[model samples]
Target: MELSFLSSPQIFFTVFTLAVSVFLYIFIYHQTNRRKTNYPPGNFGWPIIGETYEFLYGNSEKFIGDRMKKYSPKVFKTKVYGEPTAVLCGVAGHKFITANEEKLFRVWRPHSLQKLFRAPFLPNASASIPRETMVNVTRAPGFIKTEALIGYLGKMDTMIQQHFNLHWEGKQKVQAYELMHRMTATLSSRFFLGFEENDPRIEKFARLSDGMTVGLHSFPINIPGTVFYRAKKAADAMRMEVQQLIMEKRAAMSSGIQTQDILSHMILSSNPAAGRFKSEKEIATLSSALVVSGFTTPATALAIIMKYLAERPDIYDKIRAEQMEISSSKKLGELLNWEDIQKMKYTWHTSLEVMRIIPPFQGGFREALRDFTYEGYTIPKGWKVYWSVTTTNKNPECFPEPEKLSPTRFETPPPYTFVPFGGGLRVCPGKEYSRLVMLIFLHNLVKKFKWEVLAPNENMIGTVIPMPGKGFPILLQPLST
Candidate 1:
């Protein structure tokens, strides 16, 4: 039978509508089945978005605390952009994930710009930078022959001496955080890419890269006049600069010249299978990552450390004595080495305590991959899980008198209770490096100058990292030789 022209349109519309209806029904059914059977209860805030709005605007910490009190240490389920999430609180919950980390915890894929910023060109860029690569580059070593811990110590000492001369010369009063950021940027560039002081690109890259932390939580839309847009522009400019450096390094390598920077190491090292080393893009991206990860944490920690010292004059005196003991036998302009830092165990402990109290990445999120049962609640697959390192550190049971700033508590605190560097396979690879930086800076600061907080009553604000609103200024007095 011949079909009428009008009837053909009617049939197509009816079939399309029917297909859509069936698809909708199936999707709804699947989502309904995927819903938690008896998941840990918590507020979802608004529909679909769940607690994302609260999280984005800085209420997540308080929200998590409130839920912990009401729900009592369980997996609190919620959603972000319609994605399911679970937040594990209390000692048991923390232990469960850390113990079975490989299975229970996964690095929630970092936001897109993270992947773009890490390795921009790959189609599957999100997955392109392997966990193994990150572990190797950020941590110690793998098939690639980056320096181990001791090598890091040597470099750190040299960098510390240079930084001291640049910023802390003759007891000048400086903004601790500002000096720290500049020093770290310079030191990291010198250590990572072997850039000289005259390399203007380092300062530009630092400016752009620092803004990236702000971009991570911003809306994904890169429309003109947006923060993300500016970040992307900055990233592109940095990338171009890196490309130029890579070409220069490659040419230098071709001529059999070996430089002492990370770029030279990357160029010379080969993959186990005899493949040429990491691409210039990869090197540049990784170089940027190293700087981004290292710069802020140490700078923020140094600021906080200064704040604590300023508040407690007694502790300041004790630390000063310790520095003097280390420096008493050494001459001016002599570099303090790794062995010297190791002698300042008390300083290390104090820094550790400060981090526990104020972790840089305060709360981390992970998404569930499969249905999981916890405390009579079934957390279905695809739920985003948040673990608050800050709040957990404050738990009274785990840390007696948790609010008090006591470094000695770490000498014997309940195991797994204080994870400022996070836990699991994803724990920060730069932990030891950060430790060395903080110890070295504190050692010198205490020895050279007496400092007191300019505004002890100023409130600290929380962002991706926490810092005092008034920028931790201190009145500095030079010590007599």
Candidate 2:
């Protein structure tokens, strides 16, 4: 009787059923216990892949906004790029994470990014300089701060003039995006690497920049045909080029051929006795990051500002008038200076409005150093957190009639509400640098020409930064002298 029962198909089915029931009971119990720990309320999507596809492929603002609507406005849980991530929204979220820098939270970049940037020990490592500190040092007084910034104006002016002569002047139509990209690239090279616009290596840097931007937010796949793989390759090439440049610059410095740009500064600081010293490799890594970050945002912002100006002739007239007033104060052939940049108040305000209307970067990431609670929700350790300027900047509570491009709204607003360059301890060090460059570009642009947007209603493609749909073509109308 026992042998016959064992051989029966029904008995086998019964055994399988029992096993499944036990498994389900154990799983449900574990999940129930985990839920009791009170992690933040929201969906984590599928295992591994998570909502990363939706976040990357779709509109960043809408994606986060919809989530905020569905879940808690302060924070929500979603996994992206194979990591469990919590997105922190609004003013409170921005303050909480930014204020807790290096305490309960630290900057986090994915493995793919760490590899691409060639920062072997990032996030937190004893041997490495913290990213913020590194950036702040690189942006100190003689680097990108006021003294160094003032010096860059003439060089930037020369580059812009060259850009207009080469790409804009005498041309019926020029792609604003392409021209801005080149101009920004040239400016970055001059300021960061001490390279002239005509230097052959400038083209190489620019091309590699394109590859790096494409890969910044892509999937971490490193397969031959993948965007990440291509980006890594480009980074590798750029890294090598930078290393050579550092060596050359070091040699030049040793021979008393001093250079005033960032690379030269880093070389001088490489002394072990100097608390702010960085090794050649470290210097190169920072320089590569600088090139990518330095140009992309300002270039994108400049293009968008130009587009908005073209659409609003009244606004354009005001900016042009202000710029002409500044130009009139300067002698012919004289370049802009620090004082001139400060005087373009209206032009700068207009730029702020454009940034608020369409931020160049949608958001940024931070990682939890320890488990923390936010608005009564427990955020576990080893989790990634995000803060979006877009979320807060567009909130009607923060900005009345948030969609409007009224610069006057900036006359008075809630503190930490409009953070185009981010805020708190982690605020972008290049804020002033970008501001100076933008004002210079605008002053030169409006002084020399008036342009009409050829594609006013074109769609915008959002990546790590927003880009014009049609490369933002414009018909140049040079202003009469």
Candidate 3:
């Protein structure tokens, strides 16, 4: 009789007791461990999501910079993009990240991209391509291609004139961004694929490349109809176009046509034994990446430089005077060779300063593959590391009076302090090409037109790439003959 009475509520009582015991154990364990180790000081907002909301809302850069000012030059921890990212600030950290230590860090590749853009040839939905392949495809070829590019530039004067005549005429305040996109596309097509100015395929490829960046800031979800989906489709189309160009160039080369475009150079290159040439697919991928990466950078840079010039009439006057002095003896169609570009050292300096102040890739992310220590803090493995270009560029210690746009600042800054092209093995290979294009275009524009900004106040929007909020509108007045 006693046993039966006890069994009625016994099961409920036992379950309640177990739950209480587990909660107390977890609470005690957490409190004890929290006091044991010294973690980097940061605001961990909540469990799981952490400080991701701040970053998603666009305050990450300002917040990180503010924290750096308060914390000094050292390693600190904060959550970003749903992960714990170690924020490295100041000059020393910049050196550490861009130096040989970069080998120890992994470039951040989003899972969404990996899933969507599967191996190019394989249909294995779950298979991921090697990281090296991605790097090779995206890496800009360095000074090895300098001589080839210079030769191409020397022979492309007529093409440049043709583009200007076609695009800049009968225009009532054309969009600066649109003009830049067209210019870069046309010039790049001629240089890379040997396409004539009127090639319809070349024009289509340029349009697709320019549109690829539109949806980059959207959510990762690739619904039935979304920007990401459209971008991927565009990329696929561009890839096919590139392949066709490569095949056509290869055929031409085999038949001894000996063209002087980038395609010809790539196909003709070989190791000492006349073997080890790039495959058709490899060549296509590399060429495609070059067009996509190369055009966007110079186009955006030109737009920004023009915007600055428009805002400050005094600066515009100086630039115009310089350009006129350079063009005094040379004719309008005369090719501006590389040596000529290099001779304009002041212009180069000015461009460098602009990039330092407003770099295209504002923040770069790297993941730690192993635990590392920086400034006495142990950065655990699997944490993301970030270097803020905008913040570091503005650091007064490295750049004295960093706010001022003085190109002379480069004369005394510390090494690795101003890395607009980045550093180490991964530095942009297209640096020479970009510099050449910018100088020639700027010199010609200043000589031909006087321009003014359409709107000065609404040009401060920031995203992955910073651009004028109102699309860099400008009113162009043709120069007197």
Q: Which residue ranges in model 2 land beyond 4 Å of their true spot? A: 1-34, 121-129, 271-279
Q: Write the per-residue lDDT of candidate 3 for residues 1-481, one digit (tens) a residue.
A: 4445556478789888998987887677557536634656554444445565465446445767767766555766776555677888767777888774456686663333343334443355333343454344323232226766676676555565666678776665878877777788887877667787788887798778855555434345566697667766776677678878888877877887877566666666633353223356545655665576667778888887777677667767777777677667577656777767667776777777777776765666778988877777777789888777765687777787876777667556678677766667646566777877888788777777878778767654545655566777888888863
List of clashing residue pairs for candidate 2: none
| Candidate 2 overall lDDT versus native | 0.81
Better of 1 and 3 by TM-score: 1
lDDT per model vs. reference: 0.68, 0.81, 0.67
Higher-lDDT candidate among 1 and 3?
A: 1
* Candidate 1 residue spans exceeding 4 A from truth: 1-35, 112-123, 126-128, 138-147, 152-155, 170-173, 269-278, 331-333
Q: Which lDDT tens digits does candidate 2 get at residues 173-264?
A: 99889889888888888888999678988878989998888788888788899989999889888888999999999888788897777777
Query: Candidate 1, residue 427: CA error in Å?
Result: 2.5
Report model 3's TM-score to 2 decimal places.
0.79
- In candidate 1, what are the lDDT values of residues 308-408, reduced to their tens digit? 77877877777788888988878876767767877887777777777776666666666676777888787777676767775667777777787687878
Candidate 2 vs candidate 3: the lDDT winner is: 2
Relative to the true structure, candidate 2 reaches a TM of: 0.89
Q: Candidate 3 at residue 270, lDDT? A: 31
TM-score of structure candidate 1: 0.84
